[model samples]
Target: MRHRHQAAPQQAPWPHRVKRQHCRGLADEADVPPAISQDWRSFRAALVAGSRQARGGEQSESNQTLLHLQDPVLGREAVWAHSIPDAEQGGLLLATRQAPEVLMNDGLEQAVVFLASHGPEGSLGLLLNK
Candidate 1:
């Protein structure tokens, strides 16, 4: 009896290598969900509005900036202990990026002073008074 050699199995092509046509009409087709389309439209509108607002100076600090603080230490004892400058005693001071100043209370307890920036949803603050 003669022995017959079997052919090797063919390998499948990679999915990444498959060619696809641009579905230009798919965007207009009613097959797309209404909610998905609405979401896309809203996203596009927001992007455009943001770009326009940015260009129109609506995002400037004078227009969009606000200050916030928590647990403020005030009065003569707090001031003397912290060694805060006389001029800045009762005023809000902008926090420096470098080493933040340490603030102390009459009880000799220490706290960090901070300047806060607030937005519509949230706020960020830097400790400047401690």
Candidate 2:
């Protein structure tokens, strides 16, 4: 006696794909530049001063802070400057800005440099190594 084989059931076609509707109200929010704008030199000076203040026992009201600097080469000059607790012994600590690409890759490109002490403070970095 020969046995008959049964065919497998087929799946129905997927429903017509519909594009998602996204809200545009939030997307229209314009980027407002900082009130005080300055050249690279002036910007760097401000950053250094702020770091010094924090180092000189000046406690920031808000533990978390976002410092914005306006300069021509923001992509290059802007960095998360930090001051070691000890000025003379610890010395100035400079962390090179890291970009998104650097963070995803190994040290193949420039490594995403960050301050070792940027703890509790919550830090985000950008790559400055062009």
For residues 23-108, what per-residue lDDT tens digits would candidate 1 score against the true structure?
44445437667865767646545655666665662333431222112222322121111222322323334433332334322422
lDDT score at residue 55, model 1, on the 0-100 scale: 60
Q: How far does residue 129 in candidate 2 sit from its true spot (Å)? A: 10
Give the Å shift of residue 102 in candidate 2: 22
Poorly placed runs, candidate 2 (over 4 Å): 1-31, 34-48, 57-130
lDDT (0 to 1) per candidate = 0.41, 0.43
**TM-scores, each model vs. reference:** 0.17, 0.17
List model 2 lDDT by residue over 12-100, tens digit each.
Answer: 65322334346443322233234323254456557777778766744443423322233334534434444444323212333334533
Q: What overall lDDT, based on C-alpha atoms, would model 2 receive against the true structure?
A: 0.43
lDDT (0-100) at residue 5 of candidate 2? 78
